[model samples]
Target: MIKFFRNIRQRLLTENKFSKYLIYAIGEIVLVVFGILIALQINTWNDERKAQKVEDNFFYDVLLDLKKDNANLNYYKKFHTKRITYLDTLLTYVRNPNKTMGIKKFGMYTEPLFYTVAPTSYETTFESAKSMGEFNNFKEKQLVKDLSQYYADFVQLENSFSSITRFVENQFEPLMYKLPEGYMSEDTGMLVINEEDVQEFYNKVASIKDNRKITYDYEIILKTPNTENYLIGDMGRSYTALGKIITRQEVLTKLERALNKTIKR
Candidate 1:
């Protein structure tokens, strides 16, 4: 093509058609400029396509993480609800001294409150996307906003959970150990007291004929009422926070499906 254009220019110059040669030269320059522009446009499209793939991968990982988070939150919901029930029963006995005998049947409802059952949120992928500005690949501003808000809320909830955990281990567990021979189970969080041990604690309480001993022994048996109150309040807050996280996880699940569908199309 270059040789053909060169021949034409030389022939035109030899024939002294200067005006025609000038027009041909301008036309050739225009074609070269147009070709360069088309090449650049194609390169830009290719780059965009690659970025879109990266965005899709990020969303896929995020969807998986959300699913895991939903499951974890559900498990926590059930676990904390069980703990609340145990706490409620024990508190009721504390409120009514007559019900304290029933506490023997309840087997000293001492759960391993110190055991942390924190939810697992796989947020590394999301954080990586944010730090690298991969979110820009997504066209929908609302999606980005929703993701940002969810992660921000997660941080707050996680911190609250950690604080509550520390409080339980440091303050509440020691108070629990002072109660009786029964102790908390390592695995199931249920208190484990031999029948003999239970009877012994009951016998000691029953034999306390002196009014002063009765009051002191009962107080000793339920030594952690204040600790329980703090735990109940904190655990309630934790439950509420977990519920919110579950709700957001469900919403994000839907969003993930929608985006995946749209991308596939």
Candidate 2:
């Protein structure tokens, strides 16, 4: 192609009649410039196609992640709500005078830990974060950079939410488990419990509750003359874990918005 153009240029210059040759020369130059522009446009199109492919893969991953996060958030929410109902009933058991009638202590409804601790369900968004790398070679590298930073910020917020939830969930073990013995009877390895012994167990219950308090040493729940520390497990507001899962749901909503805009589009 180069040789053909060169030959045309040389032939035109050798002609004495310059008018016809000048027009031909101008036309050839125009064709060459047009050809170069077309090649550049094709290159740009190819790059865009590659970038779109990367974005498509990334969006699919983010969609799956959001769905998982949403499902997990819901599961934790349900877990927390049921726990609250049980906790409220236990509170009633604590305050009622009928507890002395040998009514079993509020152990049955709260005794799951005797058999097994309720397994915590976990949801992860890190897969979406990792998948954004599909766009690493994209012409618009900023797409990946921006998405990665967004995910980082989101995950940090998620961690904070988890910390709050841990605080709440941490309080639950003490309530469900009677002692190191859990909800089981120490003498018989049975779950049957009596509240007559439970009033006597006030200090023991407080001891268990106290251990879960933030101020284990300050001695707040220790009733008069019974100075035994009631503290047992990590302290937190009862619904704190459930609340964290709820907050994560909010984060998932935000993540979905981001992914749809950045990836799906």
Kindly report which residue pairs in candidate 2 clash with one another. 165-241, 206-230, 207-230, 210-231, 211-230, 211-231, 211-232
Residue lDDT tens for model 2, 105-178: 43344442222113222223344445555445554465445545545545544454455345445544543332
Q: Best TM-score goes to which candidate?
A: 1
Clashing pairs in 1: none
- lDDT per residue as tens, model 1, 100-202: 5433434446543545555467788889888888777676567667767777777665765676677777766677566543321222223432212344444
lDDT of 1 at 159: 69
Give the local distance difference test score of model 2: 0.49
For candidate 2, give the lDDT of residue 173. Answer: 51
TM-score of 1: 0.70
Q: What range of 10 consecutive residues in model 2 has the weakest lDDT sum?
A: 226-235
